[model samples]
Target: MSVALDGVGFVHANGHRALTGISLSAGAGERLAVIGPSGAGKTTLMRVLGAALHPVEGRVAVLDVDPWKLSPSALRKLRARIATVHQAPPIAPRLRVVTAVLSGRLGEWTLPRAIASLLHPSDIAGAHEALTRVSLQDRLFDRCDRLSGGQLQRVGVARAMYQRPALLLADEPVSALDPTLADATLRELVAQSEATGATFIASLHAVDLALHWFPRIVGMREGRVVFDRPRDEVTQEMLTALYANEHTAQGAADSAVPMHLAVCRA
Candidate 1:
C-alpha cells in the first residue's frame, strides 16, 4: 500500500476538532478523489496524509512507513518522496518561476548545489520541460508577482511534477482555473502520475471533476467520511445526500439532480 490511515483523529491547538476516525487506504499507483463541502476536514486530511500534521490519535502509514515514527532525517527523506500541490501554492511573489520549480528538489540536493541553484537555477531545461506541461514554458523566468491566479496555480503543479514524487497529493489543485484549464491540468497531472506509477490522491470541491478523473471516490462530511465507493457505484442520490446540510434533507435530496448540478458548478 502507498497510503493508509486507521482511526485517525486530530484536534487543533484552539480546541477545534479537525478530523475524526478517518480510515482510508490507497494502493500503489491508485487514484482517489475525496469530495465534500467546506470544513469537511479535507485539507486537514491532506496535511495528515502528507505528514504535515501529526494525528492526536491513531496511525498513518505513507509509502509503507509511518512518518511520525521515523527520525527527523528519516522523515525528511520520506517527505521527499511525497509531494503536495496545495490549493494556494505558497510561493514568494518575487521568486522566479525557475527557482520555484527547482526548489522541489532542495530537500534532496546538496547544500552548495541548493544555494547555487537558488542564486542561479542550475536546471533551466528541466524547469522549462515541467512548465511546458502546464503551458507555462514562456513564463519560465518571469517573477511570480506578474502572473495571474490561475497561472500561479499551474506553476505549483509544474513544481510538483518536477519533484517526481512516488506519492502525489493535491488539495483543490485547480480551483482557480477556468473549466478548460481545469480539465487539461487535471488530465496532465493524472496522466503523469500514472506514467510514473505514483499513487495520486486529491481533495476536490467539484464533484464532476472528481467523478470524471478518479476511479475511487470518498465523501467526507463534518469531519467524517459519509461514503467511500468506486466511481461506477457512486450514485447521484448519494452525492446529493453527502452535500446536503441539515436544512437540505427535506429540500435538496428530494430532487437529487439539481443538488448534484449545484455541486458540480461549485
Candidate 2:
C-alpha cells in the first residue's frame, strides 16, 4: 500500500474528536476524492494520511514504513515521498515564482546546494519545465505576490510537481476560485498526477467536480466515514441528503427576508 490507515482516531487538545475509527488504503496511481461538510474531519484525515499528525489510536503506514516510528532524519526522507497542498497555500509572497518552486527540491538537495539555491535559484531549466507543465512558464520571473489567486494555486501545484512525490494530498485546493478556473485547475492537477503515476487523495466540497473527475469517492460526516464507493455508485439523492442538513442550518442563520421586514410581515 502506498498509503494506509488502520482503525485511526484523533482527539484534539480541546477534547474535540476530529476523526473516529477511519480505515483506508490506496495503492500507487489511485485517485481518491474525500468529501464532507465543514466539520466532517476531512482535513484531520488528510493530515493523518500525510504523516503530519499521529492518531490517538490505530496505525498509519506509507510505503511499508510506520510513519510515527521514523526518526527525524527518516521522517524527512519519508516526507520527501509525500506532498501536501493546503487550502491556503504557504508560498512566500516576496520570492520569485521560480525560487518558490525550487524550494520543493530542498528535501532532496545537499545542504550547500539547498542554501545556494535559496540565495540564487540553481535549477532554472527544471523550474521552467515544472511551470510549463502547469502552463505558467511565462510567469517564472514574476513575484509570487503579484499573481492572481488562481495563478498562485497553479504555482503551488508546480512546486508539488517539482517535488516529484509518490503520494499527493490536497485540501480544497480550488474551493476559492471561480467555477471555470476551478475546473481548469483541477483538470491540470489530475493530469499532472496521472502523468507521474502518483497516488492522490484530495478533500473536496464540490460533488460535481469529484464525480466528474475522480473514480473513487469517500464521504465523511462529523468524525466518521459514511461511505466509500465508486463514483458510479454514488446517487444524487445521497449527496442531496448529505448536504441538506448543513445547508438548512446556514439558511436559518441567514434568513431570506430582512429581520425587521420579517417581523413586520409576520
Candidate 3:
C-alpha cells in the first residue's frame, strides 16, 4: 500500500497558505523524514498525509482511496489504519500512562467497550507490552503529568504503537528531549514500527538525526518542497543551505550539548 499526493495544496481558514502544490508518496515500511525550519509547513503537510486535513486543491490517495472523497464513517475507518503522534504529548495529564496508551485501541473497539475500558483499561497486557517496548513499563501507572518530557513523549509513542497502524505520522516526536533520550526514543519508534511493516513519516528539525535514521529526506521551505532524496544523497552543505538564516544549526548544536553542562549553564 502507498500514500500519494498529487499537486496537493492547502490554505488555512485564516488565509495562510500552508502547502502549495506539494506532491509526494511513501510505500509501506519506508522511513521518510521531512526536515525544515519552523513554520515551513512540515506539520501541515504531515496532517494532509495523515488524512486529518483535506487539501483545497489536488488529490490524495491512501491505498487507492481518496481521503477527501471518503464519507465521515469511511474517513474514521481509514484513520484507524494511520496514527499520528504530535510534538507535545497529547495524553491527559491526569490520566494514568497505561490508560492513555490503551486508548489507542479505541478506534477498533465499540463505544461501550471503550467507555467501559476507561474505568478498567481493557488491554492491560497490550499496554504493558507497549510500555516495555519504549522502556517505560515501570511507569505504566504513573500520571502523565508526573513523567518527564522525554518519558511523556515515549508514552505517546507507545500509544501509537498499540494502534498497529499501517502508517505512522510523527511531528517532532523527539524535539523536547535531550540528545541521548531523543536518539533512544527515535530508535525505539523506528524499530517498533518496522517490526510491523508500517511506514513512517516523521517531521524533524535536527538534520543530523534525520540523516542518521531515515533512508529518505524531504526538505521544505516556506510551504514548498525544495529537496527530496535518499540519505546518501543529502549532504551537510545541503542541510545548512536549506535552513540558512534560521537557527537550525544552533538547535542541532544545542541537542549535541551535554545536558549536565547545559543545566549548569542555566
Listed in order, each prediction's TM-score against the native is 0.92, 0.89, 0.91
* Candidate 3 residue spans exceeding 4 A from truth: 250-266
Q: How many pairs of residues in model 1 come into backbone collision?
A: 0
Segments of candidate 2 deviating more than 4 angstroms: 248-266
Clashing pairs in 1: none
Candidate 3 C-alpha lDDT tens digits along 67-125: 87889999888888888888887788999998999888788889999888878988899
The order by descending TM-score is 1, 3, 2
What overall lDDT goes with each candidate model? 0.88, 0.82, 0.84
Q: Which lDDT tens digits does candidate 2 get at residues 1-266?
A: 88888899999999999999999999999998998778999999999988889899988998779988999999999888888877877998998999988888688889999889877899999999989877799999999999987788878888887888899889888876787877777777788689899998899887666766787889888888888987767665556555667885334223321332213120
Best of the candidates, TM-score:
1
Pairs of residues at least 3 apart in sequence or in different chains that clash in candidate 2: none
Error of 3 at 132 (Å): 1.6
Q: Against the true structure, what is every candidate's RMSD?
A: 3.7, 8.1, 5.2
Ranking by lDDT: 1, 3, 2
Error of 3 at 65 (Å): 1.2
Regarding TM-score, does 1 or 3 come out ahead? 1
User: How many angstroms is residue 45 displaced in model 2 relative to the true structure, after the best TM-score fit?
Assistant: 0.9
In terms of lDDT, the best-performing candidate is 1
